[model samples]
Target: MKTPLTSFAGLDLLTSAVIVLDAEGSILFANASAENLLDSSFKSLTHLKLTDLFLNGEELIEVFHQAVAHQFADKRQDLTLERAGREALHVHSIVTALDNPDTPVLIELRENVQQLKLDREERMLDQSKANKELIRNLAHEIKNPLGGIRGAAQLLELELPERHLRELREYTQVIIKEADRLQTLVDRLLAPHRLPHIVGDVNIHEVCERVRSLIVAEFPQGLTIKRDYDLSIPEFRGDKEQLIQTVLNIAHNAAQALHERIRQGDAVLTFKSRVVRQITLAKVRYRLALDLHIIDNGPGIPPEIRNRIFYPLVSGKEGGSGLGLTLAQTFVEQHLGVIECESRPEYTDFRILIPLP
Candidate 1:
């Protein structure tokens, strides 16, 4: 059974903080969960401007006014709201205007961060477990077959007549090359999982710098790796080698994808890092986060396979094994981080977010 709206004094969902405000920005109705979140009751908070309740109240009110006036099409905005105990909230706001414009009511929803924190930990654990299973199956099923293929190709090379041997050798060489290629891919896919994280104080900028130099050395003529770094971020404990590999894989993929643009002398790969506080990813929450964005000015990811881009062996490039980003994702998730891709024509950005120590 469910509580009726007339009898139910609190919000039905524990996951969100729901509040109903009039066009004048007066707090008209708050469900029980919202009261619990704001640390105030409807009786005392009625007719009070929401901004007056916190440090950034004025800005919040201004955004709310603009949202209502414009009949805001975007459901997302950066907000700093507060709860009753004066706990500062860094949240993403989703606002909806009521049908009646004269008495338009706004709904502001906030996530219950305590649960978000717990969910993050759980998600990290789950990702680690899944990665282990993936590596194990792929290594046994895909890697183990390479040796036989290469051996068979070698045997076939010796059996052909000398006059026809050139073509036969070419065919054998193709088989051996492809088998070796697959072998290298399997090694890369399983590399992160096999090595223990060598945790030490690491300067993230140094890691980025190393990747930049490597990319420049490989593509000296046309491609350029640009740095847009926030140098103020302090050193944190992490595996220096793993971080290098994690970033190298993504940048390498981007470089390879920009081959045409590089030839045309317009290729650009940008690395940007910033400190973010109170982030929620994959439905989990974190107190402090580091956001690193890898942007490339190239053709965007194809729409049909964009959602499945992160899966193992899924590549947008011909001759690509598609395990580079997968391994990078595995390495990052080992550090309780996430890698997400957003691509559009003329621009593609791969954003990596990790918790700050």
Candidate 2:
């Protein structure tokens, strides 16, 4: 009663797309992931040739032939595989010569960018949780001592006699001022957690427009805000005010980073939106998602602190509080979305992706 299907049942559980080919390069078997990747049923896929599934099938076929002849394994990186009426996939293809006489070649396709992105997002989610706890405890510890310190300073200032008032009052003034500053910082640290999650259908372009107006008003002279929006994108449900604040923080940071460019009257900030299909975020696959990009023409984030830019109190600019991006990320994540950044000299891009219902 044990059939070929039962023999290869484990392959169906693998995440990577797998296909077995006969000596003539005809598909002998296609696993569950292969069916998902190719957008075809296993029965339909088995009737097709390997060349029919990939845009670069000729190159892959050559690799397969060499692997079968030499009894070796080969890998091709960044190969584009095409599917019927669907977008092409970028994957790393591995060809190996099977030891069996019937099925001679095995092909495995692993999505290059998506797999890496999912891994990064998973790590970020874990790190975000740890950071939240650390910030809460740290803020509480700092906050409790602050009120007492400010109160003591005020009492000392009132008790000083007229003769010593001027000298001693200066010290108390410093204490009270520093205490107030620390209190403000603690408030900011707890701001995102304190806000309510107000959800509704949101027009992404409207959020972009609001951020554009705010950035231009503050910069005023040299910076230009450009919009490249896809009009066909449907409205999705999220927190409107939080989304506006998220985009504004990113744009504001870009504007601040463009100090030299602004002075030269060549600073450019772009807001581009598009629709992405068959995307995965937070380990869940989405049929459709929104891709919003906030790009800037600045010197780019400093290399040293780039990795830790999302962490609290990490800043590239002098006297920067460094909470803007952190809060933006927190707000986006609350909407079951993610934000990613890529930066280099003269070009810095911040991408925010949210699932569409």
Candidate 3:
């Protein structure tokens, strides 16, 4: 006999999609989350088998069979779920055997972002806190001594009247120039923090377009910027110019890294935007958020500095000040967002996640 539908009433409260099935893989019950995830009403879903909802579900079927045979829990990752007339979903799922014979297997489905979102959010938050404290303390220490050193050099230069010590004036000029350079560096470090966010409705695609145009204009010859935007994304409150600067910083770095590929006329930079659901950023869970990906075909980030790319003054490129990514991070954080990167040789993906109201 089949399990009664009302037996799994308590499962409706679960956020993760869940289904209860008999030993033969026919679904006995699906929770509210399962309904939402599968985009089908429970009444309609009741007529379908569990494995029928997926494409290439042979492994998933085996997982279910094993769970039923051994009465143990089985875990699987990166399972593709096929939806009729809709894009497929990549999911991670777990199957567990039930004590009841009528409903022998319990399957829980977790969308791929559950763990990835938490891991990246935690990493970016910790890194941002450390970077902020370091920048603040370092800037304060440098600024105090910096002003005095520049002032003293100016006085010493003037006092060494163009007479016998004229050549010595060159030394004073060097000191003043170096001090000024250091001061400028300190200012740049503090620039992101100093500016107040001018919050307004910000269309992320607009920002992307601006950055794309600027990059194309700068490169002009060898790079192609492709757009894959989800027009349904609504505008949210943010500083438009800051967001623009943030994207430009990341895109500019990518373009610079793609110099060899660009020279060969095969460079590609893709700006893909989509709406992600239930993402966590900086310890806060958001129901909806924007995920903007800047994907590039380049030599990839140097492995040595890849971990510290967001740290101030840590640049992998020749003559790079290394402040670009740092500033970019600060700007994104100001908008309550986080940027995460994954890279390999000839491919790089940078994902920016910001909550939506």
Q: How many pairs collide in each candidate, listed in order?
A: 5, 0, 0
Candidate 3 steric clashes:
0
By TM-score, the better pick of 1 and 3 is 3
Clashing pairs in 2: none
* Model 1 spans > 4 angstroms off: 1-132, 145-181, 281-284
lDDT of 2: 0.88
Q: Report the Cα lDDT for candidate 3.
A: 0.88
Error of 3 at 75 (Å): 10
What is candidate 3's lDDT per residue for 1-357, written digit by digit as tens?
766777789999999999988877887789999999899899888888977787667878888888888746566566767767876676888888777788888889988875556655777788888999999999999999988998998888777866747789879889999998999999998888898889999999999999989998899998999999999999999999999999999999999999999999999999999999986678888999999999999999999998899999999899999999999899888888889899999999988889998
- My TM-score estimates for the predictions, one after another, are 0.60, 0.72, 0.69
- Mind sharing the TM-score for model 3? 0.69
Candidate 2 lowest-lDDT run of ten:
1-10
| Model 3 clashing residue pairs (backbone) | none
Q: Model 3, 128: alpha-carbon shift in Å?
A: 0.8
Q: Compared with the true structure, what per-residue lDDT tens digits does model 1 show for residues 89-202?
A: 766677766555543555566764555454544655565577569777978799777899899889989888999998779889999999998887778777776888899998
Candidate 1 has an lDDT of 0.77
Between the candidate structures 1 and 2, which one is better when assessed by lDDT? Answer: 2
Model 1 TM: 0.60
lDDT per model vs. reference: 0.77, 0.88, 0.88
